[model samples]
Target: MNGCAAFCSPASTQPALPLTLAHPLAHHSCTMFFKILLLSAAAFSATTTAATTYKASFTQYGSTDTWGSGNCNVASTACGFYTSPGYSAAVSQNEFGVGPGAGAGPACGTCWKLTAQTDSSGNNLSNAGNSIVVQVTNLCPASGNPLCAQKGLTGTNQYGANLNFDLCIDSGASNALFGNSGVGLAVGSAVQVDCNQWSGEVVH
Candidate 1:
């Protein structure tokens, strides 16, 4: 049956009606179809535009001190290393509360954009303009350690550590985000964080 005839089954021996744009019912159906298509496309665009943004703190780490332990021994599991000499690899605390972790486990190399920094007093730091993107490489502070609790993380399996990143000082470029060889920002300094993009293998 043609478009018009498809909507109505006439009993008489009638030839299939030739569908035309001028047919009111046919035009209404086509209009509704296009409207539904446009609405679906709009909803998809909204979802893609909605990215997660939050605030977290950071700590700095060095190459020799932070590597060869936990999951870092496996290069594939290690936080991605920057090739530049001064550039250092970075690790994420399992307690950041964004990804999956049970004391220690792969976080699927999730990447984040460190957009701005603030001091413990909530003052915006000079380096707020320096945004750096880093991937999660290693689980930090061990599970159930008292130090993790001291950092305002109050859950078992290292779930509560307030620390968000272990910036690799050896990864030279990343240090600039924190300031002067990573010494500019002291440990426990608060920073604004945003979930800019996911990279590598993300779990869920």
Candidate 2:
């Protein structure tokens, strides 16, 4: 069948064929096939598109945002340097690149913009939408955090999140993003973004 002729009859002066008259099901079949193709294309696009923003869980740690000692023993985290004056985070084991036992990985020094959305228990937060950018300075060992246990590219935590950011409260990020409610766990979204003018270890 001439698909172009069927779909673009106005482009030509030739009269359109009356497929419905000649073969009752021809036009219907063509329409159905085109619909199927469109649906398949949409599905393929959805699957091929990599996720840039991820649903994530955020927890606060009461530790100094100093450069050195802690999760990453070197002089300033696994990432090797402190961010700005007080903006650092410990990412999940998988995303931290190196395994729990290692000090660094590919994700070290990566910057992420995190926005608080809800509590760890899924309750909507009063301070939802507050956001902050932080650099990955440490690793949230999966062995220590049950929520960080999710592994591999498709791994997800109990909340169906693939990423976890444990913000250093002393860094001021938690206070800014969650106010007094930043003590424990919170739910949010995380997106990798350009480091821009951020002063920190070279972002990977």
Q: Pick the candidate with the highest lDDT.
A: 2
Error of 1 at 55 (Å): 1.2
What TM-score would every model get versus the actual structure? 0.56, 0.64
At residue 182, candidate 2 shows an lDDT of 45
- What does candidate 2 score on TM? 0.64
Q: Point out where model 1 deviates above 4 Å.
A: 1-22, 64-106, 142-163, 180-204
Computed on alpha carbons, the lDDT of every model, listed in order, comes to 0.46, 0.72
lDDT of 1 by residue, 4-37 (tens): 3554434458554455524576557766776887
State each candidate's clash count: 9, 2
Prediction RMSDs, each to the true structure: 7.1, 7.9
Error of 1 at 56 (Å): 1.0
Q: Counting only residues 3 or more apart in sequence or on different chains, how many pairs clash (N, Cα, C under 3 Å) in candidate 2?
A: 2
Q: Per-residue lDDT tens digits of candidate 2, residues 3-115?
A: 73466334447566655444446556667778988999999988775448988988766545344433332345666655546477888887887775566788877788898
